[model samples]
Target: DIEIHVHPFALSYCSHGYRPQEVLPFTGSMGPFFNVFCATIVSLSLWRIRNPKLLPLLMWAGTAYIAEGVAMFIDIAGLPILTDWGKVIIIGGVSPVIIGILGIIFVTIGSIFMLLLMPLENVSHRDSFGKKYLITTSISFYFLLSVIYTSIFVLFVLDNRLIAFFSSIVFSLLLTTIYNPIFPFLDRLSHTKTFQIGWSEVKIALGSAFGIVIIVLVFF
Candidate 1:
């Protein structure tokens, strides 16, 4: 049900005009180093901050670093990138063109929702409608970004366009339904005393994992 224009890069690269294989060696080598450098800066900056909200950003960074590291290694091994799994998700790699339009819609919707619904800094307190709104918007944007990136990765791998669009609609609607109901309960749970204690534990674990990610990226 969606229409998309394939990026010009796909067309330009088809004739071995600019072989991705040539760049893969360099990118596969340097990407992790760059990620490690960035992670180091983030880890240092985070030590001076007390706001727990930044944990999500750190986790996202760590996740991408790990994923890129895997993808790069796979590329080095002459294998398809791990990030290209979106093709697998799109009905067994048959019709993949819809991902581009889906990406555009997701990003546009997410950005608009974030601009309108993201809360003020002091809206962190429990039982506030602003807090719930912020959580909903954040979760929505996270999923949208995840899907967009994966779809782009698949495009990079497959380089095929002019495929069916309707196949992905049901999956998107299902995800919408699943995420919408959970946020209300998540908001309620956050206000409980037990949740506070559990949250602290989770925060500590995330902090530890963030540090470990930085160490791994820097060293290995």
Candidate 2:
């Protein structure tokens, strides 16, 4: 039952226009692949955090990103149990509930870490945006992406687009506030041309791939 409700909204979104069983393959494949990508992002952020050249704020941002990625991945990784039994590779007797609990732990720790790393003293506008402003913007953008996905789930799966839109606004506000403090660490990190260019490319590539996957599922 945990699996049934894990990403109930997401599953609903992807299953639109198809029988429940029909969408399992698409959801199953997409879920794990996206989660693996999250794991990669977490690893990369942690690696960036280890670089001494980066400022303390940037390192904190990396740590927060890692927490966010890990939390999402943990939840997504549990999908195989229900979607594809043949691929259900349990980890030392761990259950879906246990993994969900672990994800919650990561979220709590990440939220606290961001709060601790807030550069309240450095509120001046060193970059195009002030520290707090940058953090708020970054969190808002990320939350918006999340809202898009959740809204799709609610709209298609739950057949309540109106409620989904309103709920997404509230969810985005809450999540953005939760991570607002730690985003300024990016100001220092973004100074590197290599990082800026590379990150932009990475985002574009991932976004394109995600769109392609969705189109494939919906039309084919």
Candidate 3:
């Protein structure tokens, strides 16, 4: 469960306040344009780059940005439906909050993992066992990160500041314990060939999806 606090003035247009209906449209209209602009610059920069080492980091950043933009649009689309529904529904209907949180989590964790694995991209050659190990390790890491982050988010949403603080400390300890052993194994696996090639394919797919998103947002 999560609680969101919106300023009263944000809902209604006060003399000095913003209104959602007006503001959302303006921001929504600009969001894709801004993303496209940034992406174009990034694409051009990548094209001109001579170094192969920088590719992973650049691609990771671009993909993460595109993912975040897509997630934002998802949340935006869900907002009106959420207002109509008047409450959160997990099973039967869409929940903007849950969806949004999920998007954030995926983008954050995926980007972090990509960064962690970037150094291994050049050295590792894809193999059957390596791919399986990569997939399993990725899933496990993602689940752990989700739990740690979501627990903190829930505590804050529940307005349990004190508990959240303590939980953060506990989670940090737990994370260190889990991460220390796994990292060495991950590093070894990375040298033997991880899923870097697969990531390239995924990046291409995401780029195509982003283009489609832009088309939809602009025309429909």
Candidate 4:
């Protein structure tokens, strides 16, 4: 059974002198969370492609961002941002509730950045390194923060310093190595509209979705 495998893994973890102060909480309604993300992405992509005019682009962009921002706040509002607003009551909504909101916002912001980098009908200085550098910075920051969070999570869950540090360093380095050189290369491909939100874009989206699926399948 899967529990048998997980049990030894848990026991081996305890034997290694790692333990959690408290078991991590369960996430509720994961399916809805996934639905929101996929639907939101699809909506935003459709909005982008359908808007031949700039006004339509801005309208949809603003609407999407506001929707995503509201979603993120639903989770984060209780995490010290605005607990008094009664968001943390926990009577409703999904697990890692904050992640539900945050993940979508990340995608939303990512879409906005893409729009900025390649405005609907203009080609001024977007090809310049100066412009793309900002986008690069945003992405690198996400990678770095993600690695740090992973490290803390590893330490908390598995309770093995060696494994935690090893994984963190190795993973962070790998991400950096691949990420550092990938931006400008990706930026170059943006000259053509066909590849704008095509293969490369889908690769990132599907990779994220697949990762979530793997995690849920492996864990709770």
**lDDT for each of the candidates?**
0.38, 0.42, 0.42, 0.41
Worst 10 residues of 4 by lDDT: 4-13
lDDT of 1 by residue, 44-88 (tens): 466345244454444334333433443333333432442332323
Residue 114's lDDT within candidate 3 is 42
Whole-model lDDT, candidate 4?
0.41
* TM per prediction: 0.29, 0.33, 0.33, 0.29
lDDT by residue (tens digit), candidate 3, 83-143: 2122233223555566466556654553344434433443232334343244324324433
lDDT of 4 by residue, 1-220 (tens): 1121222112211234445554223322332355455655665576545432322223334334433444454546446432212232243333455555565675455444344333332323335544434433433443454456545554454334334334434433443344335546545644324223445544655565456446644764
**Cα-based lDDT at residue 126, candidate 3:** 30
As a whole number from 0 to 100, the lDDT of residue 4 in candidate 2 is: 25
**Candidate 1 off by > 4 Å:** 1-28, 48-50, 76-144, 148-220
Alpha carbon deviation, residue 198, candidate 3 (Å): 20
Error of 1 at 33 (Å): 1.6
Candidate 1 lDDT (Cα, whole model)? 0.38
The residue-level lDDT of candidate 1 at 61 comes to 40
Task: Report the error of model 1 at residue 84, Å.
Answer: 14
Error of 2 at 117 (Å): 9.7
Candidate 2 lDDT, tens digit per residue, 1-220?
Answer: 1222233124423233434433333344344445445644553465434322332323343344443445345435645554332132242334556555655665554444443333422332334333444553444444455457756555543333334345434533554554434445544543222222245444654565456456645654
